[model samples]
Each structure stands twice: as structure tokens, then as C-alpha cells.
Target: MSLLEAVAMLAYYDPDSECTVMREVPFSDSAHILLRFLHSRNFQTFMDGVPQITDFRYTNEAMLGIVFDDNFAPLGMIQNSMGFLEGGTVVRKSFPQSDLLMSIPLLSDLVGSMLGKGPYFIANDAGPSPFELGKGPLYRWANFDEVGTQDDPLFQDAGGTTTYTTTENEVSDIRDVARVIFKGPLNLTEWYFSTRLVADIVAALFPFGRDYGINFLHGDKLESMPKIEFIAEQGVLSGGTFMFLPIPGERELIKGYNHMDVLTACASLPSPGSARLRRAPHWNQLATTIAIPPLLVPAPAETQTSGVADIMETIEDTLMPSLVLIISYDDGNRVSNSQTGFFCTPQGHILTALGGIRNSPMVNVKTIDRGVFKVKRVMGEERAFNLVKLTADVPASQMKPVSYNRSIPVYGTQVYAVTIPGPDEKTVTALQVTGTREIPGIGMVILTTPSIPAYYNNCPVADARGQVLGLAVSESSGGAAVDFIIPSAVILGLFVGATPVSFEDWEAREMLQGLDNTYAEAMRLLWLGRFTAAAPLFERAAKARPQDADPLYYAAACYENTKQAARAQTLYEQALKADPESVKVLFSLGLLHARAGRAKKATALFAEVVDREPRHAQGHAELVKLYAGVRNRDLMQKHLALLRGLDPDLAEDTLYEIESAGRTRR
Candidate 1:
């Protein structure tokens, strides 16, 4: 008998004790070999319902045992209270009671391990007595216990025994070996005795594994084997339909082992259920279903031309509220006539025509909001004409001044013109020149106008580069262009204090100053002669000193002289508002009204002036003229009398001259 057979016999003799068997199998073996091994080892082993056993001492312990299957797959060792034993070994009987037995390869190792360990077995106090040693006596004793003990007085008595009849029962006489077989060497590390044990260890080590329970016997089914033919339904592997043996120490390599056909086959066999067995099919399917797709989005559409236009409009709308004034001048009388000749300086100063402020000594400045401010600076006082400078009270925080250039170059080359029109509806143009001339010396050019009368007002013209070249003082019909520009070099010498000149070469110096000044004086004489055509020349002079009332006053007179009564009236009114106390403006206002055929209003205004200044001879004279036109003979005589009282000689001559001139014209 083998050593294994001896161990089995010793376990079988004691009916009150449990037992286990352990053995290893090769990869190439049959299941019948395992049966024969168990049969030889245990006294209850039966082949074809016949009990068979070999002498315990003679059994060959060298024959390890038969493999559980043809493949002789290696089996995991299960450690239980009975001690550790190899898988596929049978349990001969249950502990402490029954004589029946069954084959459970998965449980054999655990049971064997428990039995081998001291905790699973105790020596029976009843010893190997006949009553408990073999099957028939043990069964009769159990049947007697099952019957009522009180009715059988023999069972109640401590030392007495009862004979009880029992029905014949089938005992598990089959010595089924629960063993593993494999086609290869049994590697100790690769075996998993039970999926339940593996899952319990994994869950204890890593708590997150509990989310999907463990399966113990998957991929061991017939369908999973390569030779088997079975159609697995799609969800069968995904639901709780399989079990698996976990590959020890190779969890990653066997992650989806439950989906393997052989593992499923092994688990599908009828057996007691456990969480490990129930979880095999669903874990892999859950993982696959939860995978995330790649992220990709479409690009935005391109902008069109119309969209660009819309964007520009939006920008304009946004900035419209912040748009400030641009430095520009109105050629038309859109602004006040008093504002006519005003020019802005690079330093943010406003330079007005000198004549604009002569009588009032104040100039009205219009802001971007159309609001007005009275400026109190006069230019061109005395005889020499100077640039009119208007300083605004702008705060440092609000002022944005421009830089000014103050360099004079020689060899006066003509560049550009900045012009204003005169009474004849023609442009009074100025020339900007640089460098030396024979007559003008340097920085001088010619000035001319077809609309202005054959006269000139000394005025400076600046080039596009913002340099002053020459004073446009005169024009002549016989000259090359019926006009002439004076050189700045000669004029500079004439002025009290002037900057020195430096030219590229002295030979290029031109001297046309004497001729230019002469023509300028001639134009001045014509302007004093009340030539309407000289209005443009006066306007040019006015632009140079726009703040002076003189130029604007005279410009208005010239307009009136040229029969522009409506324009004259508006201009005179503007002048009067600028200089309310100016006798010239007051006189112009009266004259403007008279010219407009408002004789009564004119007469009343003149009479008021005479009343304010009792000795005002011009005012009395104007009153007389105004009264006479309205056919108010009495009021006319009264004004005449008043003028006579103020200036007796002029009053008598005025009456005589008026009568004489009236007769001669007729």
C-alpha cells in the first residue's frame, strides 16, 4: 500500500473523525487514475459498488497519486483548518459524525490542511470500539439516537445499549479523488486553489477590488477549451454567468480570465455559490463599456467683407462720444464774422487779425460746443504790425501744445499759398518763398489777387513747412503777374529788432524789397481811397491779427462800400458786440441799417449815440442824414441844429456842401 493509502485508512477507521487527502498530478494524466488512487487509499473506496482496500503498510507512497484530468494541470494548494493539501484530493468523511464522503477537489486542499494542522482533529474517547469503528454499528447507533430515547429504556440507561432496526441508506462509498492535472510541469506559483481565497486576499489588500466581486472558477469550462464547440451568447460572458480561478501573483496577465472559455467551463459546473463565483462575467464588460472617446470639435467660420464693415461701424459708434475738434478754419461765414481771420498756433495759441480788436480790445472766441469767450489781447498796436498772440486760460492738465519751429532759410523758393478772398470775389493769394533774392534779400515772395483791387496790405505768408517767407504788401497791373511779393530780408532790416539771415550763397540774394514795399504802399493808398477791390487785401491783413477790431471794422466798411449791405450789417453787428463802446462799430452799425432801408431804426440809433456823446459831430451828421431819408423834416433840422451847436463852422459847411453836391450831381 502507498503512504497515501495508509493515511486514508487510518482516517477511515475512526467514524467520529474527518479526513482529507493531498496529491500532485502531472500535465498528461486521466481522471480515472485519481479515482483508482483514492480507491486504494481508503477502506470505503468502491469500484462498481464493491468495497476495495490494500494493506495500509504495503501501499506505495512513491506513486504521488493520479492526476485529476487528462491534462494533469497543476492545482493550487488550499490551506484550511484541516491543514494544507493539494487540490483534487477527496474528503473521506465529514468531521465527528457521518460515514458518507464526497469528492471536492477545490475543498480538498483546505480540508486536508485543516486536518493536518492540530486544530481540526481530536482523539475520540470512545476509541476504536466496534460500535463506532465501522459503518453498520455506527449507523445502528445513530438510528437509535434518532428514535425516542424515553420509549427505549435501554438507550436511557447509562450502561445499557438498545438494538434498533434501521432503514438501508446509500453511503458515499465512492473514493473520488479531487486532484488537478496539467499538460505542463506544475509550477507552484502559477496555481490558484480557489477563486474565493484569491479574491478574499485581493479585497483585503486592496479595498477598491470589492466594487466588482471576485469569481473563482472561470475559463475552466469545456467551451473555453480550444477543442470545444459552443456559441457563447454576447451577454453570457458579461452577466453573472461564469466563475474563474485567479492566477496568483499574475493578476494583470489574467485580468479577463473570467472571459476565457476554459475558466468559464470550470465554474459552470454545479457547486455551492459564492460572491467570487458570481462576479466573473460582469467585471470585464463594465470596464469596456466605460471607456471614453477622443475629444474633437469643429473650427469657427471665417469673417467676410460685410462683417468687417460691421466691425468698423461698431468702432465708430464706440469712439463717437470721444471725438474732439480738429484744427480747421471755415472759409464760409459759418462762425462769427469777428472769428473770420483767427488762426491756431502750434503752441495752441489763437492768433486773430489785429484790426479785429482795435476798437473793443476784445475778441470773441468760439469753442467746439459753440460757446463763446471774450479774449483781451490786441496785436499790431502803434505803427509796426506784429503777430497777434491770444493766450487761452487752458489748464496744464487740459492743454496739448504743439512745438513751433523758428528757423529762416535763404534762397527764397516759392512753395505754397494760403489765401482769403476779397470783395471782387477773387482769391487774395500769398506766396511762400525761401533763400536770397537780389532785391528782397531772403525769405520773400510775390503776392497777387485778381479779385482784390490794385492795392496791398502788408501781410506775411507762411509756407506749407510753416515758415514765414514774405509780406504781401502790393500789386501792379504792369508787373509779371499783376502782383508782387516783398522779400523778408529787406523787411527784416527795416523792422526794429529782427533775426540775422544765413543763405546758401550770397550770389543768390534777391533785392525786390523796395519795389514790393512801393507797390504795398500803393495798395494801401487805394484801400484808404475806399476801393471796394481792396477788401481782399484788407482781409489778408485782418487774418494776420484777427483779434483787432480795426481789420474787421474796415473789412465790414469795404463790404458795405461794395454794396454787400446784408453781409455788412451782419459783420458790423458782430463788431459792435465785440466792442460795444467803439465809435467806429457804432457808426458802422448805423450806416449798415441806413443802407438796408431801415431809416427809422438807423435814425433812432444815431440819435441815441448823439445823446450819449453830445459833442459827437459824426453822430449828429448821421442822425441828420437818417432823419432826412425818413422825411422827418423836423427831426432832421433838430439834428442839424445839434451838430451846429457842437461844431458851428463844420455844421454850416456841411449844409452848404450837401446842397452844392446835390445840385452838381443833378
Candidate 2:
């Protein structure tokens, strides 16, 4: 016999029950071979004939066995689990030779679990066996030697006085074989798994194999038998909440299992006199509930009031003496730039921005009640924060240190910014605190609404109580007069005693590392309506960065603000030549052309802007007005429709222009 046939025979035999015979057959396919199992039908017929045997039915089985090569490696598999009809006989099917199926460890583990072994010989004992039901003499037909000895009671009769010869060669060869047997009526898809195996096996095949359940078999059919009734019990291994509902038109009997991750139910309901089982739809009559509460609303806060005049007088008396005008000069004695500063200590340490004094060789300080004095030494400097501390020979009475408010200011807090234009002359502007930001290397800086001018750079911004918050550091952005402020906490660190360096040594350090600071300073002047003062700075920045069109464009804007159109036009064209793809320059140049009556050139430039950036709302707005001027209604409406989606407010204004133009024509 072949190795697979021997293993199948050993796995199918039961010492206390009926035995099955395995027969080898020839196959002409990819399978190594085929086998047929013939179960004995006489035992089932005998049990049915006996009146004492109750609820007894034969269990149909299917098995699959794997065959290996000479090297003990898997060559192919054979299975009688799923049989098909070929010609006139039901031919058993074998799983196709595949590396994917053989490589699965679960398949090998399952096959190993069902393999059973038997002893070489049977033994008879005088005492009754534990498995005895006392029904009658249970028998196995086997030939035995008269003088031979029995070693086991596996095939002993109910009275325990039976013996048989050995036929263990067929069973002992299955030690290296792997096989599995389904003991009941076989299903093509559903394989019943014990609760212990379900955790590992069912979890691997979930969703696709979601219809798994334990099969319950009742009894055999008889001519005059009562209706067959059965109960299947399943258990779990852990504790949790569970619910059980009643079945329709039946006694309500339900229970739940612990550690049951997945529960599948399949029930059969039948009318009286029905003999066959019918499938039903899946169970879905379960319900659940949850609760939520209402949301609460918050009340508005009361605004705090403070004395503005009292704050102003306190600042003038305490901080005005320390405020000084910083002036720098070139080698020819000509003034380069000027800004504001304040004395941080009684030793004449004046703190100010580094921008105006970076490249100047002759830096001087003008105090409130003292004459102009030349700086003697550089106390400290932090270029990233745009700060420089200097000492000069000022009168002792003029060195009043300003009080600092270390507490942070919040939005909507009223504050004042003080600027010293010249000796004993000060400009104080009241501003509302807008917001604040914490920047790297600069720490926390304050932001406030704009009322101060461009020259307010380096001025001190004080709270209502006349305490200095921070020094105004940079240009205005959005609603804020200053983009950022170096807080009082950061400014106080410069007074921590350090070795003083000569003015030449301080100037020898790196000066004006980048052009961005220069451009930002120019933008501040431009935004403050100081066209003349801002134009020269923009021009200086443009000369430094020839490849950048922003400086040139803003310089042109400054000229345009002053009504110097000819100069503005020359600079605009130069900026266009520098970066032809700049959207800002393109739109500005288009506006200039439109004002100069070059309608065709202006319309073409605006069209290019819309094509480059489809969502530019202002580009469409300008196009709407230009088309309406020429009475091009169809083109005007087309661009208007595109504009409405981008900016509805701008589109409404364009629609007003279109209607106004129509009224003028009538």
C-alpha cells in the first residue's frame, strides 16, 4: 500500500466503532494519486434495526491527506472532502499542487491535530471497561493465533473477553504523515472550530468566513418516529456583558458565552408536519441607546477703565529725560541717518536700534537738557535683535532710567508710543494693543494698532501706568504700527556689566548682513506717507539687490504717490524688465498704462495676470472696469462671472460700475 493510503486507514479506524477501508486508484492528472474510502453501511443498518438503540445515526466523514517525496517534502495533497461526478462514478478531488497552500502553517497545524494512532495488537481483560454501555457484545472481525498473547483492551467486547492478531504495519507508518478528518456531514465552506481553536483560526479568516457555527445532528429518520429535537451548547472563557433575545413563535431560551468576540446564529423554524430544515435570514432585531446634554452659553466681560492724562504726565516726568536723538555721519561730515534712543543706566548707557549706526564712523547722542555728545565706548550689541548699547559723557542729571513693566500686555490694552525728534521735543501717540508674538532669538514682542509715524522706530511704548513695555523694533503690518517690539525684559539684559569695547572695534564687526532689513525700513516709510524720505531708501535697496524687482517696484510706487509719474513710469519699466513674471509689477504697470490712456496695452497685461493666477480677485476686478469703459458687455459679463466666485464683494462693486456706465451711455 502507498504511504497516504496507510495513513488514511489509520486515521479513519475506531476500536469501539465501525471501521472504514481505503482503496488506492490510478489518476491521470497533476495529482500524485487518488484514493476512495468505502464506509461500511451494514453497521448503520444494524443500529437502525435494533429497537433499543435510540437516536442513533451514521456520521459521514471526509478526509484530506498530504503526500511527500523521497526527501519528506510535500509533493501534492489528496482529499475526498469534496467529490465530483466524472463519467458514471463520483471521483474524489485533490487540492491542486500549489506553493501558496503548502506554505501556510495553519493548514499544516490543522492536519496534524486530527492524526490518530493505534497499537500493534489488542488485549482482553476480565474486568468491565469504563466505556461499556452494557447494550450487548460489541465485535470486530479479526483472525487471531490460538497461542498468541493480547497486549491491549482497545477491541475488547463489553464482557471484556476478546482477542485479535496484530495488523499494525499499516498504522505505524503514519508517524510522519499529516491528515484531518471531518467526522459529521461535510460542508464545502463551513468547518466547525472548537472554542479553543476559534481565537486563532477564525480570526485569520474573518468577514469572508463569517458564517461559521457548530453543527448539531439529532437522530436518524424512521417511518413512525416522533419529531427530532436537539440542543447545541457553546461556552466562552471570559466575562463581559451579553444579551439574549427570544425567537419568533417559540419558547424563549437564550444564553450568552464569555470571551465570544464573534457570534453567528443560524436557526430553523418549521410548521407542523414538516420534515426538512429550511434556511432563514440573519438576526438583526437588536437595539441600543445613548444620551447627551445641552450646551451652555458664556456672558460678555466688562471693560476696564484707566486715567490717560495721568499716564501721560507720569511718562513725561520720568522717561522724557532719558529719550535722546541718535545721529550718524559719514567720513565727509554729512548726516547719514537719524533715529531715537533712551538711557538704560545712570552711567550714560544709551540703547537704540543698530540699523542707523551700522556703517557710520561718527555716532553722536543729543540729550534733552544736555548738548550733543560723541559716543565714547560700545557697551554691548545683539545684531539679530537690532539693538546696540553705547556710553557717552552726558550730565548726571539727564541719565534718568525709565521704569519697565515686566508683566505682558494683552489685546485691546491702551498704550502710548513716545518719540524724540530733536532735543527737548517729543511726540507721544496713543495706540491700542492689538496682539503679541514670541519670536525665536528675539523672545516675546508686543504688537499694537498703528497711529505712530515711520520715525517712531526705536521709540519706547508704555502702558497706561507709564511703565515701558518694549522698544518699537520694526515696520507696521496689518493693524499694528510696529511689526514687533523687543520687550523690556530683553532690554534689561544689556545692563549686566560686560567689558566695554572701542567705537572702532564695534564698527569692525560685521555690518548690515542682509538687504531685507533695508527693504523693510523703506516699506515702513512708504506706508507712513513719507514719500520723499522713503524713495531714497528704496533706491538704495534697489542698487544693493539689482536682481530683486520688489525694491524697484516700491520705489516706483513712492514716486507715483508724489505725482512724479514720469519717474515712476521709468522705474516701473525697469522693474518689469528685471522680473517679467512678477504679478505685483504686472498689475501696477497695467494700472499706469490705463491711467495714461493706453487701453489696449493695459487690457492685455490684466489678461495675462488672470491667466497666470486664475483666482486673483483684483485682476478680475480691474478687467471688469476696463471692459465696461469700452462698452464690451459680453466680455465684461464673462469676466464678472469668474470674479463673483473669487471675491463676491469686488464683483458687486464691478456690477455697480457696469450699471453706471450703462446709465451714462443712455
Candidate 3:
């Protein structure tokens, strides 16, 4: 059966009705914008290694027409036709032609403003109709053709699955719209398509936004693909989809078998015969293989290295030696923590994240070959960026410091994280550059793949060539926590010819916190396990902002961390008095009371916490523990169910504890 293949799309989503309708192929707002920008000759070069804008070969109108069919004329035929709205008798009409005309000028102005072009040429000069027939396509609901059931011949090979019977009029306001178009394969496997391409288009459409949804689809081949594609409204990066249909008796399908070949290439096993179909694990693997007898030679000694693998090899061979394990010990408790660090200079200078060594009395560095050595001095620091440089007592010969790649990688560039998991071995993770940030004095920090491993913090992130891009550190952006890097330039910017000071002396420097210091910084220190350092900062903030309960609540936490139970209790009480609605403070105070053998008080406080924030998983967990301790089966089971709903993993472990405790009581 001939499956649908070789189709390109220009689509828009109506979030109100949650319907995604195909836009007029080349005349859609995004398609128009992209074509106009390309034809303007303004954008030529992008980041290094990426193809120049001209290489995609779409500068000319004829070349562009090969990929994009004018769906506008067909859509205009039914623009005046009436359609029913969801659960409404009102007949709504869509004037796609008029809507498309109005949006072009607005979009043109936006592009002209951003590109510094004085009145860019309007690609489509079709003015809006003076007489209003119906609503613009952007505001109206989408309608579908009655193409019969799923068993219809139209959908027999996934050909007519995505067919849109009607089109919405394009609107002038394109803020909620995401720009999208399908590019043909660059060669065979890779396409000219990348997030950078989509991002640039989005930037033209919306001058200021980074959290907009972008979906990427890359595959070798597909046929009768049974899946639905979602366009995210808020997601930054999402996957894409591909469909392939092999027309029966087509010469291209017989001789070249490009469509069939793509599917076979993705298969896990060798093709049994000509166009043999079989079940496989991955989506790409759902294919019939073209079977042919093979004259097999001896298996090749080595497979060709991919770009990612080559980058990883460079990291393992060259960068790993430069990385050292940093162990920091707290003053009184000698509580030690280990994080990754790397040599930054030939003089045995090491650079790592500040949070790791913030409140440590002593810090030690362990190298692969040189063994463990004490950190002699703090060389430099950028507190805001959470980066610090240190001088260790290691020999210069043992320090294979990685040099900086001065040029920051553009968004979508590939980066590698080199993490020293042990003294003798290392783990390398390849990450994609999502975006970047330029901090004043600190220079550019490269944001990469989301949710970096905690152990990867303070590790060195390098480019494909083994040049250090930056030191890996986690930062919260757009309300989602993602890891990024403080560039080597930022690390170098820290050293302003100032002489190094001993760790003890640097610890004293933190005592000079002033009015300029922020409560957020104090909270950060607290999060880093530097309770002693955070306690004073929190107290200062509490004194400065008397009405705020956060400072008092966090200060109490700092005291609790440092084992001053009474001071913690007083502060927690004061915080509660300041903000009775603060569920976290209530929960904390309850835990303190429970610790002091006040079970009834803890139970009451925990109940109040659950009441205030019903989804408070930790509060529910605490109640379960308390009820289990008292062997109160019914209450324990109730809270256990709640905990299970909130955190199944925690509930499973808690269930184990409750059963074990019951056995002990019996």
C-alpha cells in the first residue's frame, strides 16, 4: 500500500478550541515571514559550522515554490462559507484572504523594527476587504471535512489523516502563534532543520521571548505512522514527527527506493527480502526490509565515529586529566562534601562553583595522578555567578589545565560535560546548547540541556574540540531549574591581579555582609548547606525587613541546621506570628516541637499545614510517620494514601517502615 510521504506543512494552533489546523502553505504568516527575511538578504551568516542561509537554496522564488504549494487559493474558495461553532447554532465565517493581508503588514513592521530596515517590502500587498463577511481565521474555530471513518481509503495509508477542510483567517496579532515549516533533508539523514533556525524565526515574530514552544522532528523514514503530534504552548523544546507513503508501481519507489530505504536503514536487523515489513521496538523500526544476499567481509575493525562520539572522545582523553575532585569540610562538624573542579591555570589554580566551598573551613583537591592536596588559597570569586578560583599546593607538572574557547557557542551548538566521578575515571555527557546569557562583568554563560546531574556541578563543560566552554552550574530560569555554565572568560575576569588569601581569611571576608547583601543570596547559602554563613545574613535581612516572614523562617532553619534548637524554636515562633498563613513555617515549627517530645503539638501543627496546603507532600509524610509511631492504623493508612498520591516512591518506603514498626511493637 502507498503510504503518505514527501509532504511539507505550515500550521497554526488555536489554543481556545485546542485545534491545530494547517495554514495556507506558503502564504501562512510564518512562511511569509521566513521567505521575506530570506529574500531581504539581511541574514547571511549564522553561527560557525552551521550552513549559511544561502546554502539551503531557497533564495529564489522558483526554488521556494518547489517545496511550498500555494494552498491559499483553495482555502479562499470556502472563506465565505458558514460553519457551526462548538455547541452553538451561530454560523461563523472565515475570511482567510483578508486576515492574511492584514497580518503581513503588521509582521513586516515587526521585522523591519528588529532588523533596522526602514519599511521593508510588503511580500503580499492584498489589502483587507472593506466589507466584513465573517471572523478572521485566527479567531474562529476549525472545521474538518467529512472524509468518512478511519477505515476510509483516504486514510488507508496515512495520506489524508492531517487534511484540514477549512482554513482560519490569519490575524495581525501573532503573539500566541509559533512559527513552523518543514525543510527537506539536507543530504540523507540530517536536515537543514535545527532549533537555531526555529529560534531565529521565533525571534523575528516575537522580539522578546525565550520560553516559547518549539518542536523538532528528525527521522530517517516513516510509513503509516500511527501517532499524534502535539504543539506545546509553553514547552521550550519538543520532538517532531515524520510520515512516509510508498506509492505502488512508482519508479522512484522501485529503483531508488528512497522512502523504503530510509525505513530499512532504521531497522535493527538486516532486511530479509525486497520490502519486507516487520515489527520492531522504535518508531523508525516499523518497516519492511529490502532483503538481498550479502557477500560479507570480515567485520570492520572500527565504526566511523559520529560527531558526538568524537566530541566525547576529546573530553575523555584531553579534558578529564584537568578535572579534580573538590572536597570541602565544614568548620565545627567537619562535614565534608565533594564536587567537581578543574585546573584553570598553569600555576595550579583551580576553578569551581562557589556554592561547593562557600562555608568550608578547609578544602582539598584530588587529582588523578597527583593524589590529594590541600587548597592553599582562594584566588578569586564571582559570588553572583557562584564561581570561585583556588590555588592548590599541587605541582605545575600535574596540572593539565584546559584552555578557554574565547568565542562563545551560539544556541543549538553541541557541548560536552566532563565529570570526574572518581579519581581514576570520568563520565562524559553530551549536552545541546539551548541558549545563552551575558552577565555584566561575568561575560557569557551557556545554557544547555535541562536538569543537569547534581554531581556534574562545578565540572568543566567543553566544546567538541576539547576547549573549555565554562564551569557547569545549575541556575533557575523561566521558573524551571536548568544547568548552565560560567564561561572561562568569566572565570578569568575574576582575577584582577589581587593576591590570594588563605581559606580562613576569605571566610572572614564573608563577615562584612552589608545592606547591599540580599535575602536571596542568604537563601542560596542556606541551600548550599552553609548554615553558619547564612544565619547572620538571614538575621540581617529579618532586621531590615521586619514584616517579611521568609527571612525569620529561613533564619530559624539556619539555626536548626547549626544545632541551636532553642534559638530555632524562638525564630520559628516569631515567623509563625508574622505570617500565620505560612505553611512551611508551621511545618518546621511542628517538627521542632515533635523533636522536643511534644507529639500533640506536632500533630496539631501538621494538621494545620495539610489544611493550608492540601498538596503538601512532606506534611502528609510527617503525619504518617507520627501516626505509625503511635500505632494508629486508621490515621496512618489515611495519611499513607495521601502520601501515595503525592509521592508514590516515598509512600512505598514509608509503608515498609510502618509495617516494620508494627512488627516491632507486636
Candidate 4:
């Protein structure tokens, strides 16, 4: 008989044996040597290095237990048993008995140590056994097909000479022993497959570990042959392994194989027995077998030293530090208030938004190092977005100014905006592109870009490639798209004392200057009448500077005059806190309460004003009014009489009129 046939016979008759044998072909031409060695061992050589065998068997009692525990009736158990046979015993039992056996407290802890925290049973049945019971062509050929066949004449006893009976208990006990023996080899196979599969998976998922190196096993040869393969090719990785037990010769009656082919394919690991297999270097250790290109050896000491020197040189040359410029605006009192400006210049001059520095007698330029320099000799000012131009003599001893490229026009070039946003705020980073259009109605340049929140001003224009186009300008709302740029040509003209094309645009200049003047005048008037008729102007101004306290204070006064007493009171308090010395606000607040019949409160407020400004005629007049409201005749006459003493021309008739008016109102 062939070696396969012998092995099959042995497995069929005494599958409970702890070991089995199979013939293997060696890679080298040493079959004679191996055979001679086998013969020397009396043809009973120990299979010490052979893979472990697996057993898979269960008693009828165990099976019944699994079924009954699942609340399955006897009929259900029969159906489940049939399904297990058809689907292969690897399928989980549909009954709850299998679940209970798996849940056995001690069993889980034992299995967990071996298989990690993963579930032991796939569904319900214990894993497939290596020695499976079957009656088919394979089993028949293996010489054990007639064991339970109904047609077997050896078991039939129709003659009444003897009677045989198979008790249920006996059947259950026999089945249980058979199942236990069958599972023995299977358990070993599962361990081998699981270990190799886990190692391969870890290796593939963690290529860095492989690159750094890793150690798996210390043994020379594995005792069990894992049914898995690891393949690595073209920098890709995958691996998996499983057991396969097939019916002899048929190839289709296969069972108990966990397919690792998908993992193998994904990991790009080699298949077993492939011609590509070779002695791979041991990972994670020197002098170990490793798979690598033939010529790629570890670098020599001298070469490594040279590489280090080259890296150092590169860092020294290319990592030099440089400075960046930030642009932003200052606070303003109107929508057209110029708060935006460029903070740095190509010539190292720090330009400012004209509006921000407008009223200040001196302009201060601050550096990244917190150095402040009072700027002098302001060259030119643009009233559009309130841009101011100046020049600083950057000495050769200091850092050389960045070279200006005249070929790049501000109209289409891309530029970056670097800014420090707040007075005490941290460094801010942002970028903007200069638009090509100049602003309409206003002389400032405008950008087609959307208003970026990071920019303190409107979007600065930039070229498509993100070079500096120019500082953007507009009415801070829907102004024209016309943008103004510190044109490369114009910048050059400044150094050469030549007039810029922009200067030729007299119409835009006069228009912007006129707008600036108009804005200043409007703001002045609005401030003067802030507590009276200029409420709308204050509202518009407040919208421009939400944080400015002046407009909001005046807005509150507007509310009061408009008969919004409560709103006016709140605003008065806010304004008083903001500007305690504001005589106008103090007078307004005192009169507000006096008119509202809050006599005591008004009196106290007027007294505060008098304390602050002893000669405040309005405070004195307001106090008189409060007293008249409370019908304090003596207090009213005394204050009125004092007013007449202070100004002798004060008409007796006027005092009489005031007194009569106060009396009439009360």
C-alpha cells in the first residue's frame, strides 16, 4: 500500500494515538541517505520534529448536554445534529448546551491564556476534530466504512438464536470518547495555526517593527506545521493560516480548514513550498538570515561618518533664521476710518494705516523684539485706506533689506500678510492676495477677494501664485473692486525721485482727500451732537468700532432724548464709567433723572458734578431744578438766589419766570 494508504488505515483504526506519520520529499537529493537512516533505526524512528497531530471527538452524552442546554427538544437536537453533519462539525451547534460548555468558567480562563480574549467557539460546537467520523468513498477506501452502516451483514441478527441491544447510555458514552479522541490532534493544529497566523498578522500590520527587526521563536524547527503562509512582495504584506481535512481522493469532502488565503494575499507573503522560498535572515538580530538586496549591506563606519557630516552642513547652510512682516489697522471712529496699513516695507520702513496715526503728533513703530522707534520724515500719505509711507535708513551694519524685484507688479503679484492682531495679543499668522481693482468713490485699492476674518482689514490683494499684490482698501463695505497697490514701478520711482503713475490720477486723489475731510467734519459734528440730534451718526460710528466706548455712550443719550428713559439710563451709566470727567455726559445724566421725577437721584448726581467741577453752572442750574421738583422751597430759593449773586445781570423777572415755571410743572 502507498504511504498515504497506510497512514489512513492507522488513522481509521486507532485515531486516538497521540501521533501519526506521513512521507515527505526532501529538497536536496538525499532520499537514499534519509532512507538508510530510517532503516538503521529499525523502521521505527521517532517523529520528533514532525508537526503535532489533532484529535476531535465528542461523546453522545456531551452532544446531548449541548443540545438540552440550548432548550432544544430531542427532535431539535436530531435536526441540529443532521445540520452539523451536512455543514461540517466546525459549524456551531444551534442548541444552548454548547454555549454553556463554552461558558464553563474555568474553561474560558484556560482557553483565554491560549487564544487571547477572543471567543473560543465560532458559533456553538467546539472546534472541528482532526479525526472525523465519516462513511463515504474516502472512509470506505480507508477500510472503516461499514462501522455503522444499516446494510452491514455483520451487525444484522434476524435469527432468534441471539439478541443484541444498544442502550442509550452506552451509545452516549461511546460517542463521547470518540469525540474526545478526535479532538486531540485538532487542538494541536489550532494552536500551531493560531500562533503562526498571529505572528504574520502582527508583522504585516507593523512593517516598522519588521524594519527595525523582531524576534519570533528561538527553536530550530517548529513541531507543528501551521496551515498558514506569509508572503511579502513589492513592499506589500499579507498572511493567514488554517487547517484542512479532506475526504481521501475525492478533494470535495473537505472540512475543518480555516482559510488564511485572504490574509496571505493581502500581506503579499509567500505560499508554502513555492520555488521563491529561501532561507530568510533572522529578524531583530545580527548574524540572522534576512531578506534584502544582495548589494545593500550595512554602511561602513567611514561612510556613516561622512553622511553625518553632510547632514550637519545642510542644517547650517539652509536653516538660517529670517524675519517676517505683519500688516494690520488701528481703531477708527467712522466706517471710512482708516485702520489698516502695511507694517513692514521692502526697504525696512514700517508703513502705517494713515487713519490710525492721523491725530497723533508722533507715530510709533514696534518691532518683534518689542523695540519702539518714533517714525520721522513721513514721505507720503494715502487717504483712501489711510496708508502712510515712510523710509528708514537700514544701515549696511544692520541686516540688509530684502531685494525689491521691480518686474513683479503689485497689481497681479501674490503677497502674504503677517500681523500681530492685538495690543497685548500673541503672534498671529494669516495670508491674503491683493486684488487687481482699485476702489470706486474712495481712493483706496479694493480686492475681489472675500473678507477674511483673520485679516484686521479688508482682503489684501494677491497674485494667483500668492505673491504680494497690495494692501486692500475700500469703504469697508460694498466698495468698488478697484485696488490700490504700491506698484513695483511706483516703489522704484520713490527711490529714484520720480513721480508715480498713481500721482497722475489727480481725480482719485482729490476725491479721496475730499472724502477724508468730509469724514473728519462729519465725525466732529456727530461727536458734538452725540447726546442730541446726531444719534444716527453715532449708530453708524458705533457699528464701525463696536468696542469704542464714546459712540455707545452717545447712543445711550440719543435713546434718552428719544424718550427711551430706561435705555438712556443704562447708557448714561456706561458712559459715566467710560469717561468720568465728561461734563456733557454728567449734565445730560443729571437732567435725565430730573425730567423723570427722580428728584433725589438727580440731586445726588448734580451734587457729584458740582464736586467734580465747582464752577459748573449747568450743575448748579440742574440742582435748582431738582429742588423745585421736590417742592423744597427754601433749597430752590437759595440756589436761585445764589445764581443771581454769581451773575448780577441775572434778571429778577427771569428768576421769577424760572420759579413760576418750576411751580407750574410740579
lDDT of each: 0.35, 0.51, 0.52, 0.36
> Any residue pairs clashing in model 2, and if so which?
123-152
Candidate 2 on 191-213: residue-level lDDT in tens?
33335445634433343221222
Off by over 4 Å in 1: 1-546, 629-634, 657-666
Task: Please write out the lDDT profile of model 4 over residues 1-666, one tens digit for every residue.
Answer: 133233333443443342223223223335333322221211222133111111222222322222211111212111111111111122222221234443676664343232222111211222333244221111111001111222321221245342121110011111222222223323212333356656644753442422322222322333342322322211111111111323122112111111211111111112232111122211233123433221112122233333333433332222111122222223342222223333335455545554444433334444444344444446564332345565433332332222333333422122333234456531221222333332111212323322333334332333323333444333322221222344333333332222333322432443443333433322333323333444555556555544434565666656765678898788777767766776556777777887888878889888888777666655776666667667788977776776666543332334434644643344
Model 4 clashes, total count: 70
Per-residue error at 354 for model 4, in Å? Answer: 12
**lDDT for 507 (candidate 3):** 68
Q: Which window of 10 residues has the lowest lDDT sum in candidate 2? A: 80-89
- For model 2, what is the error of residue 295's alpha carbon versus the real structure, in angstroms, after optimal superposition? 27
Clashes of each: 90, 1, 11, 70
Residue 252 deviation, candidate 4, in Å?
Answer: 99
- TM-score for each predicted model, relative to the true structure: 0.23, 0.31, 0.36, 0.23
lDDT of 1 by residue, 1-666 (tens): 133334433332332332223232222233444443333323333233222111111111111221111111122122110111121112222231122221454343343222221111111122244344222111101211122222332212233342211111101110111111111122111343446656565653443432332212232342433331222221122212122533232112222121122232222212122223234333344335544221111111131134323433443333222112212222352332342332333444444333333323123555433444444333212122323445444333333332222334322222222333335522223222322222200223343322223333333344444444444433333332333444444343332222222211111221211112322332343423434655565556555544545555665666776678776677677666655666656766776787677877777678777766677787888777666555688987988998888877566556644553443344
Candidate with the larger TM-score of 3 and 4: 3
Candidate 3 per-residue lDDT, tens place, 560-581, comes to 8779999999999998888788
**RMSD of each predicted structure:** 51.6, 32.5, 21.5, 34.8
